[model samples]
Target: MLSKRQSKYFKSLQLKKYRQTEGKFLVEGAKGVEEVLQSDFEVEALIGTSAYLSSLAENLKSKAKETIEAKETDLLQVGTFKSNNTGIAVVKIPGQDRNVVEEKGLILALDAVNDPGNLGTIIRIADWYGIKTLVCSMDTADVYNPKVINSTMGSFTRVNVMYADLKDYLSKSDKKVYGALLEGESIYKTDLTDGIVLMGSESHGISEELRPFVTDPVKIPGRGGAESLNVAVATAVVLDNFFRG
Candidate 1:
């Protein structure tokens, strides 16, 4: 059973301000918590049932600083989910300065995507397509938000998310920039082999500040008249085109 202070501390991780202040975030669900255990991220605590803890590899069980066995009741008490919850972990957020992106590597750059679920789905898509670096404007959804973390499932462990000034990052670069726009050329007609793929928020399209940096503005062709594709759906389609090319 968790003490009052311990429960309070874990509960605080659900909020962005507390997560930032503590330099930690919560990773919920069996897959997500398991991935964090396997990765280089530091796990401060693991809260789960006895059966869940017993199922982990011995080495993985040993890596965590602390492990507290709890029932479904405790999981419900502290987790963001209402049901089907298994585990929740308090883990250290890795520094964003890691130079993981190689020169000429294909990257996904997000503008001001505010939806946490969209951000999470985007991370999963990036992982699915073998893209390792995901850069977002400082205004993009917080990767550590509980919704985003839950949505990633487990891909959060594989993708490196960097927050920076999009304009500053793209303007000084020489690589191709493909901006997905409603009024741009067909993505099928463009070469997406290299450079950054810039996507915008769910409500707003790509920002004007970043337009000057786009080498080629492209869009997905649609026969039916839908207003526009959802950001995550559009990103998946765009990435699929890149894969098909």
Candidate 2:
């Protein structure tokens, strides 16, 4: 059973401020909850319906410090989507410092990629390519957004996302900057160094504010009528080549 105060607190997490203040976020759905359970991040509490609780009783029993069986409606109140309330797990924030940017090789940087789904898909792709860290500009979408988290499909467990002053970070790093651009040299023909691969927003390419920081600009050639490729698709293609090279 969920107390009124608990329900209110969980629901408030949907807002960014509350999540920041409490240093916790809600992970909804079975896959997301399972990821949280398996991840190193601390689990604060777990709430679910009886059926949902019964389904994962064994797994949730050990990892979660507190587990409460509540009505489906109560679970829905705190969940991002009302369609499926498999479970809701309150996860402590992973306190990531800016120092992670100095880590070597193929760091993916996002320049105002606003779509949550696109951001999540990119994170999944990054995880698959073994690029464990992502640097997002301050304008990028929130990593913990429900849409972003849902789209990641549990790949978030292995990826570390950090927001920073991307332009300044790129400028100062000794790592070569490879920005994806329209008129840039073909990715197939270019020689990519072991460094950061910067991708841009869906609507706009890399922001003008960051263009000066790019040491190497590359592009994927296309013969199609479309103006450009989707940022997520482009990211996959670029990472694949970078990973293989």
Give the alpha carbon lDDT tens digit for every residue of 149-205 in model 1: 999988988888888888888977788899998788998888667789999986789
Question: Model 2 Cα displacement at 25 (Å)?
Answer: 0.7
Clashing pairs in 2: none
lDDT of all predictions:
0.87, 0.86
> Which lDDT value does model 2 have at 191?
85
What's the lDDT for candidate 2?
A: 0.86
Q: Once superposed on the true structure, which residue ranges of model 1 sit more than 4 Å away at CA?
A: none
Clashes of 1: 0
Local error of candidate 2 at 214, Å? 1.2
The TM-score between candidate 2 and the true structure equals: 0.93
Would you estimate the TM-scores of all the predictions? 0.96, 0.93
* Model 1, C-alpha of 26: deviation from truth (Å): 0.6
